[model samples]
Target chain A: MNAAEIYKLSRLAIFWLSVTFGAVWVACWGVGVFIPSLITGKMPFLLQVDNPSTTVVFIADLLRSLTPILSLLVFIPINAMFMVLFERRSLALFTVRMGPNRHGFDGLAQTAADAVKLLFKEDITPRGADAFMFTLAPIIFFAPSIFGALPLLAAVTNNHDLFKVANLPTGIFYILAAASIPVVALVMAGWASNNKYSLVGGLRSAAQAISYEIPLVLSLVTMCLLAGTLDVVEIVEQQKGGILNWNILGGGALSGYDKLAPYWLNLVDTSFDTSAMFGQFYPVPWLSSIMAFVLVICTVLLFGLYLTGACAEINRIPFDLPEAESELVSGYNTEYSGIKFAIFFLAEFTNLFVVSSIATVMFLGGGDNPIPKWILDRLPLEPISNALGSLLSPLIKDLMFIDPATFWAAFWVIVKVYSIVFFAILVRGTLPRFRIDQLMDFGWKRLIPLALILFVVVVFARTWVVCHG
Target chain B: MEFVNVQELVSTGVAEALAFYFIAALAITLSIGVISDKNVIRAGFLLIGVFGGISGLFFLLQAQFIALAQVMIYAVGITLVVVIALMLTNPRLQNEEAEEEAIASSEPALLKFLDSIRNGFPGLVAWIAFVTVYMAIRSEHWEQSTQTIGEDNIAVIGRALTTDYSLPFEFASVLLLAALIGAIMLAKAEKVEDTDTPREGIESGSN
Candidate 1:
């Protein structure tokens, strides 16, 4: 918590994250843009023109189709490495200890080194273990993470043309469905291990996941009910104005009602058209304002529920009972070794990233500046962007390379998603793990009931707030 | 020219057709494995594979929500619960004990065949049901809907659930509630009795 420690951690985090981002950029550009140009002897941008050579069009299309998968493959491993370093560094800051400082620049290369070591280690299958399942389990656990986060990439990047195919109409639902598959993988690993500790661990994971999933689904369902659509892009679009419009604040409940209430009040008033007078006197109409307040409270509670369930789902600290070292000996993955174990490790961090991104899209405004548009308009950002855009116009507009909207969108997404990730790390630092019975009780008896009530309340309260529809 | 037509076919409708066949093949294979797998837990896991393949088909059909529901409810939730329960009960112990008994008794070959057939009765019934459904599908000249799922299918579902199909939806909810309550009561009743016996063992162990 010391200022110096925080500064050092932040600097370290930024440096590593930039490395990951750079690697992803290079890989994506190399495969999706440069290689196609090399092969076809034409720029991808030129292929977009009317009646371009069909061969050029086909090659570009193929490259575009492959970009999402290629970038995702590059992104996951690098992002996981950055997150591992971030968590260790943050934990060190909390505990007043230096963490992973021996390797490249405050232990940035530590995870990479560990990954190499893991790859070189022996992958062993026990004599009594189900060998096929033992091998397949980690693959099952890890594959969904890659696929599940694909749709979010589209939503986060403001539906960038390259990622538009990932944007299913049932976006968040597909992600949730994919996310749920990992617990099955955990159970499979546990049962296939032929070890008692692994069995117990896997069972605990299954129970915890199934129980907590209710609250998580309920909270997201509540957000969907408020937003009135399942499309992640549309949901994010609805929350565009400011902080007040974000789903965390009832998806613009107050701001929208403020606009509509004066007119409705004037319609009822017989004395004169007192709508202007009403606006002048009571700027925040009382009844709908009260409903908006309730909506905000419910939204906040649902967001909290979502965060808790997400933490549990990803098996982060405070909900890592399945892998509670004191009890279950690393739980379901006790017998995993080498690359199998590496995949599990990678998927865990990737799941954390995916969960954070989901929260950003659903609760925080995805790719939206927190600053209101009016204030942003008053500022000199547009002119600066315009100047920058003019300078890069040839590279941007004609070449289809650097769009300011996509740039800002990606910037804000990174900011919001990483902030959520930092908050998760903070929670891990502060809270102790829950006892098994306590965890069950909290998920089933408390969170689920609260989430259900909040969902019902939002269902009713959304009608009073005009923007929700 | 023939090659160009073939390529065009692949570029247009062949991909979807290929995908449908691939997923259908996978589901059929996995379903067979589910029935034929020797280990109960492995069979349970195979059930998930079958569900996943079916979900892929649902995805190909543009039933995205249904595809997701199939994965969530059938592939992950139900199959995981089944597998966990099977593991917890230690079905291997029962199988080992059964094997020992069979060894001791030394059943005749004909009887053994009959016993396996008896055990396979459920599988036979499942096959019959599948064939019946397959035949029905083949016999019907189905008019497949030309309409694709719109962007607001979820909204359509929500409105339908509340308006046109509200009664059935409410009835389904009631049935689920009933099932949940029944399960809880059964569990609680057993727990009370089990706890009473466990208390005596704990007291004696402490002494």
Candidate 2:
């Protein structure tokens, strides 16, 4: 609406974002750098190449595994808290109502208060529920979100060695496999609750997930094929240098275009045969150019297909049929209370964040400046860069508290991820829930076929031209 | 600080052995629970654990792709469908039907004998399979390969599948396509009014 209200929302977002980022940075530094060095001499894990004691090596190796969980443990709740508040406020803005403003200044502290209340609330197991599975359900649901996102750490952090332990050779496949796991938890929660609505919700979720996972998996698989690598870091690395090199922008179709860009941008007059160079890049001339154009369109559609499938997979509106209140009375987790409910709530948001991060890494250029390097190099950004570098120098060098690349990587990732998150929330506000039959029909008939066609098109089209990885 | 050779500490070490035993124990326990548990759905859920433990063993063996595939396919996809099918079908009705058939026909002496123990027929079959595999393992001369399967094993596998194993891969895909087509044929509905005999019903208009 008005400029003043917009200003207030921006300010609110800044406050919560800083709180999350600041806390996360401190925790990562502590686990990844400080505490380990404090315990086993003042050498960093980065010095593993240097001959170190078994204790030092052991602690370093151990902390590498711990780093993902530790960061996630710190990140999830705060991020979820911010997301919930942001969602409520944004949704309220859309619906023309005040949302949770009574708790704290303009509702900045509302989700924090809600989170505390949830933590202290009574944990209830419904009568006739499977007690063991009922208790284990939330944990099963929540655990995968942490481990599933570990590979992304390397991708997001630009393949920093500290997070290298999280990088698997199978990469996105591992994450997809992990993503498949949470449905079982939902089913368990549904069955253990011994509620009719819960069971229906659970079965619907299984059917939906099974249907939608095809397109989601295929879309990502198509990207992997185009990129020529399954490794997340390699995929991200290939999309580096500029927005044109990014997977979304014709994938590596622009790579040939990319080489000739800097010369034009810098206003260089080449004595060499530019036409011949162009011919060299595109051997078949018109046919190759057309194939490149086709690949670009296919990739864009595949990305949309991914978002649609991912929306259903995570049970977000209009695909959130499993938890539709009208039909299933809050669905599978309806019977859960207190911390368990909080956990399911937290994991759902974290899943959203993880999905966005995957989108950021695979589709969007993770941490790469949208402006090409030559342009960015020529901009009047040196002073600001130097000033920030100086400010972070102590943390970067003396204490090894920050890696500069990781810092900027983290920054760009945040910007890209949160934009996607905001878009998802906007979508939630806009769409109506799909009927169960309609949902399945759309997933299987529309999205899967479209995804398959796009995948096959990409498979053939990529061979005629160079691709990112 | 005390130091140990990194290779000595990890490869063929106590940790690996311990992990192997732990996963094996978990798998055995879950497999037993899959059969012995009275509640069939619960047993189905335990089957997930059995598959997961085996995947964990695969992880230890450094076959990450296979391990993840195991979880993705068998543990979640096949098992969940199996459990759902079991839930939808009436076991009591099946048992009654089977007993009736046994009574109606000339029941095999071995079938009656095997019915005495709990899950006797399947258990005996499983034991025989396990013994055959064990005997095969014993007879074979096993050697550790000098080469290490590095992180880029996926690329190597991909290359081999397309180059050397392409024909077999194509054959497997053809087999799957046949199965898929057969399933669709079985499930497809017909125009009820056109058909005779089995199609004679009140619902003549139903597809």
Candidate 3:
């Protein structure tokens, strides 16, 4: 083939490959809806007798497995774009002014427009800079965010697994390790920029990241200790009893009681029936229950610190001194513009969502159905009672018959995560940037020591309970 | 290295060829860049590429965790630290005349000896090590060992690290603590010196 013809052919090949990949992704979503049971074996409580054809089952399973990933692939860019718009609007609102109201449905398409502008913008290479590393930094930063999602979201089952591309037993650790990679890219970007401010920002980021990373990891380790597995699906399963079973509710010990008084105060009275806290199979040891309570409290505290640390690590507001626009001129990203800058922006939002999702799964009882059994039992299902039940029952029951409880639970998880994200955005809108020294001190003096002490308490409690029991 | 069937042999051969091509390309490209790049930062980044390619070869040899750890700690962490240091020092913007004078003063014989070692020794050792290790690995009865260890179990690794390698892990923690303390002291000393010099100058001027 002639050179021009060969170039055209190569271009066509690339186009077709991308198109085929996109088609497969959409097809997976369609198959996932109809034959999800085939992918995930069976619904949690449902039973099946005869098996489908192995070939058909395998194809369905594969498609179903790819669905969540495909959805995520589509979701990330859209989410990033919308979040940018959201942040702009929120900031405008906070400052009492309209912002970016022109372009694409009153700034609805602002992010997309910005993205296009960035794509066509000039790519600048600073003098004396390493051109290759400068170009490579953003790609490295973005790639890990995508790959990190793989292990975090992947689920597996015996016959079928739901929504996961691959299951790693060390899934939690993989997420931690993978997420840590973007820090390297940030440092690279700073160095490659050949700017003093960028270098300082990068140094500050590294120190801040390494500091917070300890507590973030310790919090996850605490969850692992409680669940006895690092697998995400298993962790969710342990929270099947809904909000009551959530680790934050102290394992349902105070489910029926008025939560006005502290748990320890209630425990001191000994008048209350603590039978509900004990397992049906075995009597709960008093010491173990107390230890478990202590561990849960420590976990919650560490989780709070972790969430704050994550916001800081991502260079979000209040702790966003590294990226303070006024001070450091966009901090480590000072020299970055166009698509390189967009990638960094995308990584930030993606990391935010990831942190929130993890918090949801660990503390908030992920994907658990929310309805209490007592409330369900109280509702009259008989003809005379059916009329009354219609009035008494929640509106959620009318929309879908597939147990509104689980739906509400999942909805709550989404709400909780979004709220955390919203709070992060609000902080960005409201709070002033911290000085770099203050940021470092907050990490080292406050967060690390607190995390370490909490970790020790958790370990000691778990060991004591185990030995006694 | 007995293959049970022709298909198996063909698949193995294809995989091996692909691996060889990538590894060889990476090694040549990175080594050339390392020597040619005038910028110290770029050279450090190139060294990361060399480490990464070696790690990929390790993965092909069925050391998946080790390969990942190598990439994580050395290629990402250590190399990033080096790049950061380079940026902090601002080597590229340093006085060119001073640099030229320093280079001119160095003995030609010593420089030539260092140059020869850098260019020649690593390449020779890499070639010898690759051929010997590849032959040894290819000729081994890997399937027999697979039967003994079972399939793709990471439990053994987890147990080994926590039990057999616990002492090393503890020692590593101590080493990190010491490093942290040392860094703090160095930083503090520099700050103290800066403050003391200013104070002493003010007092002498007042007197």
| Regions of model 2 farther than 4 Å from truth | A40-57, B1-12, B91-120, B189-207
Model 2, A246-266: lDDT tens digits are 898777887777777766565
The residue pairs found clashing in candidate 2 are none
Query: By TM-score, who's the top model here?
Result: 2
Tens digits of per-residue lDDT for model 3 on B82-108?
A: 766776675556478578657756859
User: For residues A1-469, could you state the per-residue lDDT of candidate 1 as single tens digits?
Assistant: 4898888888987888788877876776676666765555644345554444666556566776678888899999889888988899888888899889889766768988888899999988988999999999999999999899888988888878777867878889989999999998999999999999998899999999999999999999889878878889888888887777788987777555434443454533455555565444234567666777889999999899999999999999899999999998799999988889999999999999999999999999898888765556557787887788789998776655565776788889888889899899999999999999999999999999999899889887766555454
> Could you give the candidate ranking by lDDT, starting with the highest?
2, 1, 3
Q: Count clashing residue pairs per candidate.
A: 0, 0, 4
Candidate 1 falls in which docking quality class?
acceptable
Q: Using DockQ as the measure, which candidate wins?
A: 2
Q: Model 1's DockQ?
A: 0.42
- lDDT string for model 1 (B104-165, tens) is 46888888888788878998998899899999999999998888668767678878999999
TM-score of each: 0.89, 0.92, 0.72
Query: For all the models shown, what interface RMSD does each have?
Result: 4.5, 3.0, 7.9
Q: Which candidate has the highest lDDT of all?
A: 2
Better of 1 and 3 by lDDT: 1
Candidate 2: residue A58 Cα off by (Å): 3.5
